[model samples]
Target: MAANILLTRIDNRLVHGQVGVTWTKSLGANLILVANDDAAGDELQQKLMSTTADSSGAGIRFFTLEKTIKIISRAADRQHIFIVVKTPADARTLVEGGVPIKEINVGNMHFAQGKTEVTKKVYADAKDKDDLLALANSGVKIYIQDYPGDKQYPITDDLLSKVE
Candidate 1:
């Protein structure tokens, strides 16, 4: 069976309960790929995410952005894959690196210094806005929805214009 990309999402908190259970179940994904540079090399993070994925009864894989870009094609053809990235930049990188992503969901991004609040659950700084703009320009649809049953808010140029 050729695995297809079920969904791609950007969430700082990668493999938590909502994602492991709700998202996986709703999407009918058998595999979850958490692609983030920091988490991939961190043994502690890997184990934690793996445990979460296990609890959800989904096969999980962890890889840095580069490694994911390199292996995404092969992985996608193997099982239904749900990809989770840590940031907008990471999603842009994946698309640029040939991941064939057409849409992305913004789940959660914590508030940080210098970031303007884009939504109750998302914050964006300059680089993040830039990355998101690039992704939009490249024909990738971006939306914010923390869960499968939530209403989706599409990311628009008008929205970005008001972020400052």
Candidate 2:
């Protein structure tokens, strides 16, 4: 059917306070789909996501990247979905898997051991930068927006150069 996927975001802290309360309401999303292999397999992580709860009263589901890609076409027909993955690589995977992702928001990707800080809240390693570049090349509008009212910074070659 018609594509109902609204916003696909890459946030390391998936379904947290900002996402649970702010983005769901802003996007008018009825479903929050968390596509992450680690969180999908861990009951504790799932439970934590639930405990945070979508203050906007949206439904939340967690699935592995493969399962999410497989079911996305069918799921889109059912609701306005907001898909969140932990990394740019996962977002790239979804796009490559034929999910009609029009745009992707890079949100909070906290400091990691090997990742270099690209933006205020975003950090990227070599692979992350590569995946982001791939998505941009594929014609997806890539933006760096941490919160609802934050100014969106478009992903460009100049921005990509800052990844180092």
Q: What TM-scores do the predictions have?
A: 0.94, 0.94
What C-alpha lDDT values do all the predictions have? 0.87, 0.86
Minimum summed lDDT over a 10-residue window in model 2 is located at: 47-56
How far residue 100's Cα lies from its native spot in candidate 1, in Å, is: 0.9
CA lDDT for candidate 2? 0.86
lDDT of 1 by residue, 103-125 (tens): 79999989999888888899988
Query: Which residue segments of model 1 deviate by more than 4 Å?
Result: 1-3, 76-78
41-120 per-residue lDDT for model 2 (tens digits): 99988887876655678888999999988887787465888889999999999899988899899998888888887788
Candidate whose lDDT is highest = 1
RMSD of each: 1.6, 1.4
Name the lDDT value of residue 75 in candidate 1: 63
Model 1 is weakest, by summed lDDT over 10 consecutive residues, at 71-80
